[model samples]
Target: MDKAISFEQVTHTYQANTPYAQNALADVSLVIPNNSFTAIIGHTGSGKSTLVQHINALLKPTKGSVQVLGKVITSATTNKNLKAFRQHVGMVFQFPEKQLFEETVIKDIMFGPKNYGVSDADAQQAAKSAMKLVGLDESLAEKSPFDLSGGQMRRVAIAGVLAMKPEILILDEPTAGLDPRGHKEIMDLAQQLHDKDQMTIILVTHQMDDVVNYASQVVVMDEGKIVKTGTAAEIFADPGWVYKMQLNLPSSAEFAQKLVDSGVPIGKLPLTIDQLATKISQLVAEGADTDE
Candidate 1:
């Protein structure tokens, strides 16, 4: 896969050289492939957030280097296109609803394009496109962002980021604090964006199920360092590493274990609800033949 972002021996501290200079990331290195959906999982202060911020020059590394979109972010030379780089990497934070301070939803969505010097008419066009992409209707354009439901507000904030038409979309706990329905909505929207736009997605979330269902790659971090990185099937096949990292296993992992104990002869250990359901059905059909 093509490399969208690369971190080479990168390290960062909160307050360098001060008494409070706590290390947030330690010699972390990884590559995020282009057009891939990758999830970064870790407990609080595990450096997942710090890692994503480096992709767009939002934060510079205290040591080592970060190369994003083929540009060395920590080079001695300055980036002439730092602004463009930021536009290329759209970041949506946790509880994105908090980003909606504008009076109207349309205005809020247009903020990014407007800041990037797009004309008013073009910005509005971008806003419209973004709204459609995020599953919002034009009727909500004039409504107050503050008055919308939590899920609606979250989508609106995502629209704000989408209006920039970024190549890479980085989300920090995008479904945080949302109910199950709202969480599903946000994730479905992300899946749609990835499917339709072929955009690279880097999701920082604690939701293990999301990793199983959505992410193509899983990157696990602990104590300010990456502990494991692999595909969803590879990582979730065993609960050992997940437990060691102090992270919850996906429900599929648990279900598979139960099936194994029940003598179902389940092989390869599925990692999603659909996979589990299908495997169970197959087992039942096989058992029916054995009884005959």
Candidate 2:
């Protein structure tokens, strides 16, 4: 697959000359495959957010390089295609309510397309489409965004970014404070975008369940550096790193590991509840046959 974004030996520090200067990212390198769903997981201050901001040129790397849509971010010359680059790589920040300044949700979502020189009618159409993708009703479009509940506001904010019709959507802690239902709703919306639109998604989250179910690739970070990168099964099968990261595995995965440790003859490591049930049923059948 082609790369939508790439980082080469990138390093960044905040307040470079001050005593408060802290290394935010260190020698981080990564390639985000086009049209894939990749999750960046780390505890707070792990550089996951810093690395993602660099993808869309929101943050410049202090050392090494960042390339988005084939354009180098730190090049000496200005990029004439920056607007296009940003249009293709949309970012939905955490607590999007803080960014909602328009009188109505419709106007807020339309802002992006309007700035890109789209006609008013076209921008409205784009706003409606984005609202639908984020599971917002058309009726809410005309209402003031601030009047909505937290979850509604969150989706509205996401719809605003979606209005840009970005090919690569980057989200920073999108589900942070949502209830379980709201969390599932956003995850489903993301999956819909990936499956239907084939949009490359880079999700920065601390939710392991979301990571297990939704991510095609998982990138683990620690103390401003990339610690591990692999598929869900590859990374979750080893509970050591999961423990070290101070993270939890999917419920079924933890159960499966415990059963294996107790010599329960599990066929394989199961990452979901359904898979665990199936494995247990198979184990029971095998024991019955042996008894016969």
Best by TM-score: 1
Write the residue-wise lDDT of candidate 1 on 33-97 in tens digits.
99999999998878898888888887888898998888887734366768877998999998878
Q: Give lDDT tens digits, candidate 2, residues 103-219.
A: 999999999999999999999999999998888989998899999989999988898899999989998889888999888888899999999999999999877778889999999
Question: lDDT for each of the candidates?
Answer: 0.89, 0.88
Worst ten in a row by lDDT for model 1? 72-81
Model 1 steric clash pairs: none
TM-score, candidate 1, is 0.93
